[model samples]
Target: MGIRLSSVILIAASVGLLSNCSGIRLRQPLRSTEYDWRLFGGSETRTNAAPQFLEPPLKLVWSYDASAGFGPSALSAKDSVLFIATLQGELQVISIKDGERLGWVSLGSAIASAPVVDGTTVIVATADEKNNVISYDFSSARKYWKRTAGPVESAPLSVGRLIIIATLNGTLLALDRDTGEERWSIQVSQPIRSSPASDGERVFFGCDDGAVRGVNAITGNLLWTARTGAAVFANPIVIDSLVIVGSLDSTVYAFHVQSGEIAWKYRTSGMVYAPAAGFEHRAVVGTAHGDLLCLDTRTGRLLWSALGGDAGGVINAAPLIVGNIVYVGTLDKQLYALELSDGALRWQTELPGRMKTSPAVFGKRLFIPVENRIVLCYRSTSGEE
Candidate 1:
């Protein structure tokens, strides 16, 4: 067996973006005040769908220098503050209104994913040997509890009073939000690179064993599992009654949320490292070949596909659906906003460096991290911050 061209490209891209952020300052900017995006996914269900719409012709509001490297994950917004973590385990808090640094807290040796913000409490997973998971209260700047799980590469999903964490060792564990104790645990015996998503009842994630598994979030009981052609590295999106997931085999599978039956599957030109961000029956996603596609969730039909950027820069970040717009950031240093109805390109811009993470929209403001070092905020030219 030989290394594939995609693997070579991914390795090169990863080496280019790996920095951490530290140092902080308090700012006198207005805050979002709303806890819009507290989890890695957009909603409580981990749908990756935005409730509000952001039209194009957006203006750059501000950009903050984090001076650190970031992972391939989405940003979390809550309570007028935005939280981002670096590979070096520095969690930097920024004010959403002005892109000002609120403060900084070093949580672990390395943070592999985004931090989950619940009110003043932040739950983050790290590569620390002693404290892989930590829950801290930001209001008083005090550490609440820390637990040594394992290497957790995915962001923790907040479900009710439990914080769901999937580890590289294939152990799905849920922690109590208040005490950091184990709520439930299950061993699937496979690596879990994909973050867990919920449909209010069951939690779904992709496994390295070429399968997508759904378990009860509260009980940790395995409900059902569906097979794929390759390992699933992208996060699963729960849309409508379907659990949409993409695989390294260049195929996307939609499983019935309740029974785990195959609903529909579609093949792309390249691998699917990016997850789907869907609205209602329409699913918008990006492929590793730099193709942006919109698929019919009910029938697996391709509504439209548009390939953009330079030489199809491999896309690893998840797509964000905001009203009539679908925003995606690619590793080719390009950010795009397309029309959700027809896959028409609406707006495009180049970043300072390659972007491997996804975008988050709170109210009318859009937040995207570029090259794992800088955080950029944008809004409609007519919209106020």
Candidate 2:
């Protein structure tokens, strides 16, 4: 069966079935190769920046079908490999250069979120029929450990030796990186959809209860909580002292990382599904109403906006900002390139189905996942310069 894209997000948030076991411990921060792009938006800063492709049209180089359901956002390493988790509980490692299938490993459960990798291990928080978190060693391709928690549709975040995640049951769990052991689990008033974001000393995450919360990363202590207008399904982006998150209320809210006070709120016509992409003084975000908007990061002022076809789609996935171009996909099954400076269309490509996963860019290659149960790799027609 195909993934229930529209119903999947809602069901994942309403069902909190926290039941399962798994084990790991890396106290002093296991010394592995640098996992530069660990979070949903690449870095904690969520810059979404990579070198630009030369001014040329892009073409599909190769395609890999997971043949299960939808795939999550593809993650890339400086080493030039793409990592992805599937709804069928499969993990795949592919070469970014030629889209060669390097390796495929099964974790034995459905993985709804992107896998976070650090050093030798790739941590995937999956939802079994029983609901639990499973950690694995990507290098050895072995099950390292597992931890029982509520249903996790959101991806887990790794900060040093700690992994932070949320559940539909209104529980926020902190797991030790090495041991897969629970650091702590804080109970919130309502269910959570926003994945956690870390700024070293503290963790910032969003919840469906219309609250954006901050918790102490080390002690799992509640730092502060601020309420928004409606459920918050989008992930928050942390830029130095500012925390940016979007809500179903059709608005983007920025808060002080320490005080949790509203720095500014930018209103949109439709629900904002992803965090704002910040570059220089501007931040870019897409609306469920099919409009791409750019706002000033400091004051939340509108810099520019562009309208696209509804395509019966929402901007659920975060956009990839390469140089001056912003790349994003829609339920319309179209990949769009917009000028970051003015929100103008650069080019658009059609895919077979809806694209729930964000684009992963490395050098000149763009790897995108479509709900048609296939992952595609495209390169600029002129090739990498």
Candidate 3:
């Protein structure tokens, strides 16, 4: 298949311009007591780390019925507001503090990718027959524009003044954040199901052809391409000068962001489909064989592997790191909180259904979306809350 582009005119309106295109800017300065999960992987880099410390013995804060089942789309939050997209073709805005439905709008298609929040605007990509990317103004409940980019299962990245999205047909489209106008587009050789990660200057993503690519965030020009052992299904995690990603060939590869040189590669026992979360000196990732491995961030050497009878389930969700603890969801319907230093199990909780969506953490609360239509909020009992 080839790349196809079309622009669909929706309700349009003028809005406040972004401060700059360097990256998404916060409406208010981030306070010490407030944290927002604004991107698919928590940020453009997709590290999936929470800013605050969250301890175990979590209490259920609230539960909201999604009406339709949740898919691979993760949740995004800003200023205590949660943005949830469902397979039922609905974009809902809810209160993070209490599960109240603040606002909602029908997108008219199934949404498998997470929505990105930039100030008062919400950007999302849909997977229905239209395969449209739409932006809306939350405050006014009006859509700024909608453009058909192709079939997109991957989440969109809102950086600077562009909304970057990759289609299943291997085309990466960069659209103007304010007008939804096409800025630039790049086509690869294979499908891109994994979400793209960015660091403002460049965007990184993996393809089904076993290639991890880097592109200029502004011009959509190819920067570098690194080949992996097998198809790359996990989102790339960009940290410092390296781009780290996992492949279905059971190996995790790290490439230099600038030169695309192989920094290190670690082989696992099973396919690595979930994205890796990084901390100080260690990176944590889960495998299909039900093992959680912690590796040296610089050397890719295995520091410790949490296996045996304790960790035996398929983990498709990326690990959530907060302080010294790592949280991961497994297909066995369990959520495990492990120590980041040694992968020791700190706590475990059973869920109502399989947990494939990564948990969203803010303040002292963790929001978990299950395969069922239920979204559960857990408040850390520790003094931090």
Candidate 4:
């Protein structure tokens, strides 16, 4: 389906951008180096870590009602706009300054991931299987290329000129970012609910086989595979030459990126579903049983663990590491911020609905994709921007 554009209207103190799916294409801005939340886990490392800082006492900057539920993907920010995909099958663009609908186009009947911005084109993969993967160029108001990879439930990882994605059928396809041609492919022969992560030289992911495998990003050659106790649904994070991930068996496994040797494995309170996040040297992860753990990235030593007290809720999304704060959201509709050094509870915000998608940030603002079909933006009112 082509785009059904819309117009942004001036309303009150804030802009009014409702869910009409209007009829005017907005300006397609170029990719900016200032974007810190442009990908699923923010970067190819799948760390969900940002160097930005924002003091508390944040006020709600703006909120945009998308009128559709979101999947396990994230909210991506590129330049002046934001890209989000709804389960109702539309890729929407919104104003970051003020939550206004810039435009939207039908990506498929179902989408479980966010759109990855590649310059003027937005790369998105649909779980609907018909339009499996598509690169739509909003600058020209047309599709750059389309291909059927598989029923992909994760966001496509852009590695330079290649677009990488994982199919539920266990096939990982690496396509040319410019022409949508196949560059490389890998078959794990098991369901890959976890998305792909990279450390420039190699790519990493988890599988249903309870194995965390590392593959060369350039040649698609299998590097090494490390076994775990149960299925590995969380994406692995590469930091300090170690690939760290969590397994459904409630264990966090860390392996050497090159040798695939087990560095360490620490058990959690419950099974892990979301990916792990890291900032400087500490990596944080949440569990289905409402456990938030911070570990040393190099040694896998437990720095501190936040059990099911105030952070009690099933965490389906990864914790975001912004500056020294660990922002965690749960299915129980609460957003908790923990101090990264000691796991001290800084504060928790009450929301209207469940938050299953990971939070993203630019500089001083926080963008959260609440499951109630709305995106809430909060910025520091203390002039930290």
Candidate 5:
């Protein structure tokens, strides 16, 4: 199916504005402590890394009941508040310390991905039959503004003045964070189910068309595009100068950001959907066949593989690596904690439903959302649910 020509023209105009420069800049050095992780993957880059917390087998502080049904990942912000956009389309902000419902805004549409926050504004992309993006004030529970778009399956990313979103129609949009106005958009072939990434100067995302494209963070111009063997569904990760992304072709790729050249590609027995967790020269990840593998990021050489129990044939979430431990969830309804260095099993926790979302580790707890519609809090200590 082709995207509407009108939408194509709209995106082209916005990207053209990037040539003007003098748009937005981060004043101080970009710090992880400032922004709230309102989306499925964490941050605008979707790094999904929280260096503050030790890996799971930690401890569950508390678990709260979500007013709406399951969608994807829940939002964990900085103010000890957890924002959840339910399948029913209501946005709820809760106290992370106690799971208390602080406030809620009814969007009257289904939210597919986790909402992202910029300053006091919480932005949510609705997958309603109407297809719109809405912003709400986290502090006051008021509607900020709303704009129509294609079906947004990927999570939204916020840089400075621009909020980047990837849609199922195979386009990336840059919108004004303050006014909800269009800034620019870039078109790609195939659908975009994976979230986009930013490194202050460029935006990167993967698509079902078997390619990963990088665009100017300022101008929306295509900076580089790299081909993969199959579709990509996970958000890409940017660390230093390297861009790491995964593909359904059973491989994890490491690419050179500035040159658009392949650094390495690690193959697995099953399809891969989530980005790899990197620590210095090594990277760790899981496969759809239920095996967790650690590889050399520079050479794509496998270091170790731990065969997990037969739960299902696919792994959807990225592994969370903290210090010496790597945590991963499988379609088998199991969450496993393996040794990061050797892929040894430390402990495993089972939930009532299949596990598709990555675990959110904060403080000493792992916030795991199961497919059965229950948001579970597991203590890293005993691996108890």
Candidate 6:
């Protein structure tokens, strides 16, 4: 059978079987040098850039059936374990090496935000009527604490001892990572659906009111707020002295990290929904009109743009930059790997469903969570093909 046909059959059979059984249990030890994807954008800055690169012709290594379809929440990895949250209110821990189900926790509510893995603690936010931010001890497989926040659709930000979350009720809350105790809360003018990006000192997030605000991480005081032409749904990526974000108005804005001053702005042909990923002097972003753009980080000048062609769908998931390759998944159930220097298509493949979350890369493997209840793994076989 063809690879796509086999993948569909495997996914169908695995989902039918795994839905009846409890999660898989594996005791594989983590590697010392393995990188951890602790946050939504891979760091407090939300750059969405991988530390290591994997070459083209990535071969399928393994696939895990999530049983239930995944939400917009992204996957997090630590050592060799992958933490995945599903729309069925389940948080699953899977072994990355062999795609074995390790363990899982049922949160009893839908999760739309990525889980944050910090050491042995895993933090996640749910989207129930009264949204909750729960912390779990992965080592003991027990709940640490559950705190109620507003309706949170954005992923929680774990910085040092604080857990930061933005709620749809226009609240930005900081809680103690260990105790789930509220440290501070600041109310913005409109709902905040974007995750907060931090640079250790201040936390940056965008609101539906077309404003991006920065608050002091320690005091919860509003430091500054910058306005855009439309609602800002994408997370802000902080690099150096600039805070970069995309808006629904089809514009990308860079604000001064400290002063909230507009450093530069770049206009695209479509509304921008994905977080911008930066590497070296360039920042890359994807748009709703199926356009991928690379811009000079310092000047906001368009370096190059690539059209996703006829099959390219809306690029909602953030683009992940690893070495010379830029990986992005589209709503059309296609994954594209573009050359970093120029937006040239190097490799593209059709997935089982839409890829709603950004992919995670560590060592030689790429982990992609699809909307079809399958997590696909690919290993780098760069020069072999």
**lDDT tens per residue, model 5, 224-272:** 9899988888778877577888788888888888878998887788777
Candidate 6 local Cα displacement, residue 241, angstroms: 1.8
Candidate 1 per-residue lDDT over residues 250-273, each given as its tens digit: 999999988999999999888898
Give one digit per residue, the lDDT tens place, for model 4 in 246-270: 9999999989999999998898989
User: Which ranges in model 2 have alpha carbons more than 4 Å from their true place?
Assistant: 1-36, 51-56, 71-78, 129-131, 309-313, 383-385
TM-score quality measure for candidate 6: 0.90
Q: Which portions of model 5 show Cα errors greater than 4 Å?
A: 1-38, 53-56, 129-131, 309-313, 380-385
Once fitted onto the true fold, the runs of candidate 1 whose alpha carbons sit more than 4 angstroms away are 1-35, 308-312
- Candidate 4 Cα errors over 4 Å, as ranges: 1-28, 307-311
Using all chains and alpha carbons, the TM-scores for the candidates as numbered come to: 0.90, 0.86, 0.90, 0.92, 0.84, 0.90
Score each candidate by Cα lDDT. Answer: 0.79, 0.71, 0.80, 0.81, 0.68, 0.81
Q: What is residue 180's positional error in candidate 6, in angstroms?
A: 1.1
Residue-level lDDT for 191 in candidate 3: 92
Candidate 3 ranges with C-alpha deviation above 4 Å = 1-34, 129-131, 308-310
Off by over 4 Å in 6: 1-34, 309-311, 383-385
After aligning candidate 2 to the native by TM-score, how far in Å is the CA of 127 from where it should be?
Answer: 0.9
Error of 4 at 352 (Å): 0.6
106: Cα error in model 6, Å: 0.2
Q: Model 2: per-residue lDDT, tens digit, 322-372?
A: 777888888778788888888778888888888777666655566788887
lDDT of 6 at 252: 96
Best by TM-score: 4
